[model samples]
Target: MAAIIGHILPLALGVALSSVPIVVMVLILLSPRGRWSSLTYLIGAVIGLLGLTTLFSAIATLLPPAPPEAKSPLIGTIEMLIGVGLLVLAAIRWRRGRRHEHNPAAGTPKWMSKVSSLGPIPSLGLGFILMLRPKNLLFTLAAGVAIGATGATFAEAVVGIAVFVVLGISTIAAPIIFAVADPARMRRPLEGTREWIERNSSTVTTVVLLVLGTVVVGSGLAHY
Candidate 1:
């Protein structure tokens, strides 16, 4: 269980470090309908992450089983593919970041302009959609694969998936949780955080993806 958790930690962090979700979360927290909307959004995101990761884990479990020390070619192949995909995404992020840095007009998504007006349902739907986006999906898949490949008992799988979901949603949940506790005090800091993340998100995600991609690739190679 510990070994499985270790393998999936980077993948979980990859999902947690998603900047857009965090940015949207901050925006939702600053809205008039902040409380309910933010809570629902967080809930929606949790469901999406939990469902997708569990689905992929189940899929991985369908693969042929191997002995404790034996190589799992299927799992290795899947991990390698996921690793390469992440590296490619890192390159794309790096390029996009350079462009955004030079273009002063580069800003938040158009939909975000009206985020303040969104109600709980829309916010909830939006949160789910965000997790379905390519980068987040890939990270979730990687974590799922890691969990499923372990062939742990049902209880261990539950615990593993739960830990992954918690870690994956930590960043998005933290701001909302804090704001709920003390909206007045957290407002200014949340605004500052939103702006900083807007400016530096690409760089942060790119670096994280690079490091995680390498680690995943190394793990994949070891399976052979």
Candidate 2:
């Protein structure tokens, strides 16, 4: 478990560092019936990420092993492909952001206008959707592949994967944890924080994707 943890922790942490979901979580916290809505969103995020990671890891187990010589390289190939995909996504997002910057109104998600109208169930669904965006899904898949590439034992797989899930949810978790520490004074700050993050989410995500994608590709290449 320790060995597996040593290997995959970076990827897990990388996946967890997304700003958009954290912003969305804070948004939920500021919504109508916010107390439960945010909590439900957090719950939904945890479930979505953990469940998807588990499924991917399980699927990895079912895949036939590559020939010994090709093993590391095969994993590397997959990682590189995922990295390239991420880079492409980053470019696409960057272009969209540029366009949005020029036409600010088009950049707004209609959902934001209706956040105050959300109930617990919708909040939960929104949380799940926010956490499961394509970039996140790919990152989770990359993490799962890294885990499987280790050929981890049962104990190693369980513990290592759990750690990955925890780290992956850290961004959203941190703010909520802090708010829980002082809900009274935190509300206004949380809302302000959310707005700031939302305003910068695209650029942040694009940078994150570019950096992580480069790192993932390098890691994959190093397998050779």
Candidate 3:
């Protein structure tokens, strides 16, 4: 389980470092309907991560058993594909970020502005969608495949998966924790962060995708 956690941590942290989702969740927490929306959004995000893990893990069982050498190549191939996709995504975002770096009219996603008006259920749904953004989905799917490659016992597997889900969602859930603990202190710092991310989300996304994609590619190639 520790090995699984160590192996998957970078991908999970890349997911946790996503700016748009964190920004959206922060906006929800600053809304008039802040408390409920924030909580539901966090809940929905957690559910999404766990749900994807479960789906991939189950799908993994459908494959016929193979020797360790044979199995690593197949799983590694999937990871490599995911890495290449992310690298391409990173390049696109990097160029886009550069293109818009000086455009005062450049705008963020439409949904970002809509978070404050959302009711609890819609907030939950939005939470789920935000967490499943393409980069995050691909990273989580890669982690899921890695988990499936483990030969841990069923009990150990469950524990490892739980660790992944918790760590993966930590940054997304950050505001919720401090909201319940100390909203006053958190608000100022978070608000500053929100504005910064709003302006630089594309760059943030690009950097994360580049680093995570490189690591995932290295991990995949190491399998051979």
Candidate 4:
């Protein structure tokens, strides 16, 4: 039992941390203006997230089991790569934002006007697509493989994965729910928060990416 518990802890931590991007995405989603319908948006977001979780879990199951020797280093490398990529992306975004600030119209592309028309289904789909990013997939796969290798029964790992995935999804969905349900009431605050985030998004994203990448890489290296 002690051994089982020990194995589960690290996997859980990794899974929890992997959800950070989702949380950040959710915050951005809620920042925009709309006629908020919390219930609809929440339900939609949950459904979308669950679908993604299910898809990822299925993919994890289908993967050929990793050799024990390969697990740690591979996972670590993946973490490091993800972290570095995020930082780089963040830097690019920051630079772009700076350029846009100098030319206000630069940030407000016409296509963004079409985003509001996307409705709940599209919004939910967008959320799912966000998770499918290469960085997220690599991290999630590494996490699943690491957990699976620890000798936990498949059933136990599934349960744990499900729990973690739900938590991650919920972190993002909460804001979507709020934004959808009361756009008018939320408009001012959401806009304020959105503006702040937008203003600092590149820096914030870079920092978070670096931190998460460092943790993942460090965890991997420690095993070596």
Candidate 5:
């Protein structure tokens, strides 16, 4: 039992960290136009995270064995790619926000709005899709494989993934719940926080992704 627990802990931490992006998405969903019931968000996040894990598992099964020489460079490449992808995403979002500000009529697309309103389910679907992007998926898969190589059993991996999904959803829901439950007290603060996040999220997310990616890539390369 102790051995099993030990093996599981790292995998759980990896999964938990990976779920940060999803948590951010959930927070974005809690906006005035994006409000969703907490239950809806929870359900959506579970479905989405499960789908991502399943897809990753399927792809991993088909992958060629990692060559001894390839492991280090592969990890580094994956990390760098993830960082670049995040930078690109942030840039696009930032530009879009600017455009929206300049032209009130040029709001986010109808389809996107519809998806946001569908609560967590659609968001989960979207998050799964986002994860499937080549760069993102590569980083995520590499991370998973690295964890497995570190002695994580299949059960441990599953538990880790589950914890991550739950925690990610909770992060988003917690703020919304607090705001809604005590609107009179929280209204101003919540609004202020929301505004700050909206204004700074792209910059903050981009910086985080870049730093994390660089560190992961550097570590992987050094290991090689």
Candidate 6:
């Protein structure tokens, strides 16, 4: 379980560093119906990550068992593919960030304009949809594969998944936590934080993807 946790930590980091979700979360928190919407959105996001990761882990458990030190061609191939995909995504993000560096109109997603008006159910739905975004999906998939590869007992697997889910959602959860803890004091800082993250999201994402892609690629190669 410890090994599995270590392996998935970087993947979780990839998910946690995703700025869009954090930004959307901030918007939800800053809304007129902030409290309930933020909570439900978080709940939806949790359900999405938990369900998908569990599904992937179960599917991976169906693969033929292998010794810890032995090569696994199938898993290796999957990791390689995922890593390559991340690298490609990183490249795209880097280029897009560069291209739009001076364009104030470029970065925000269209749906975000509607975030302020979202009710609890819509916010919840939005949260679930956020997990399906390309980067988040890939990271969750990688973490699932890592957990499944460990061949841990059911209890251990649960623990591992729990850890992954917590870390994966930490960023999105943090602002909600702080805001709820002290809405009066937190609103200003949270707003500033949101703007900063929105401005630099692409850069942060590019660097994270590049590093994690290289790490996963290395792990895959080690199987041989």
User: Which model scores highest in TM-score?
Assistant: 1
| Per-residue lDDT value at 172 in model 2 | 80
Assess candidate 5 and give its TM-score to the true structure.
Answer: 0.58
Task: Please give the lDDT score at residue 160 for candidate 2.
Answer: 70
Off by over 4 Å in 6: none
Task: Report the C-alpha lDDT of model 3 over 110-133, residue by residue, as the tens digit.
Answer: 757888899899989988887678
**Backbone clash tally (model 3):** 0
Q: Give a tens-digit lDDT track for model 1, residues 72-160.
A: 87788888899999999999999998888888697776888988888999999988989898988888888888778678788888988
Alpha-carbon shift of residue 137 in model 4 (angstroms): 3.1
lDDT (CA) for every model shown?
0.89, 0.77, 0.80, 0.52, 0.49, 0.88
Tens digit per residue, CA lDDT, model 4, 24-64: 44344554433342333445545544555455555545545
lDDT of 6 by residue, 12-117 (tens): 9999998888889999899999989999999999999999899988888887665667588788878888899899999999998988886767757677989999
Which is the better candidate, 1 or 6, if ranked by lDDT?
1
TM-score of candidate 3 on Cα atoms, chains taken together: 0.92
Q: What does candidate 2's lDDT look like per residue over 61-179, in tens digits?
A: 76555455544677778889988888998899899889888998785577676776678888788778876788888888887776665677777778777898898888788777777
Which window of ten consecutive residues has the lowest lDDT sum in model 6?
62-71
Error of 6 at 49 (Å): 0.5
Residue 29 lDDT (model 6): 91
Task: Report the C-alpha displacement of residue 27, candidate 3, in angstroms.
Answer: 0.6
The candidate that wins on lDDT is 1
Number of clashing pairs, model 1? 0
Give the higher-TM-score candidate: 2 or 3: 3
Deviating ranges (above 4 Å) for candidate 4 = 1-105, 108-110, 179-184
Model 5 Cα lDDT, one tens digit per residue, 90-180 = 4665675577677878643455445435555555456545445443453445444443333445776566555544553454456556755
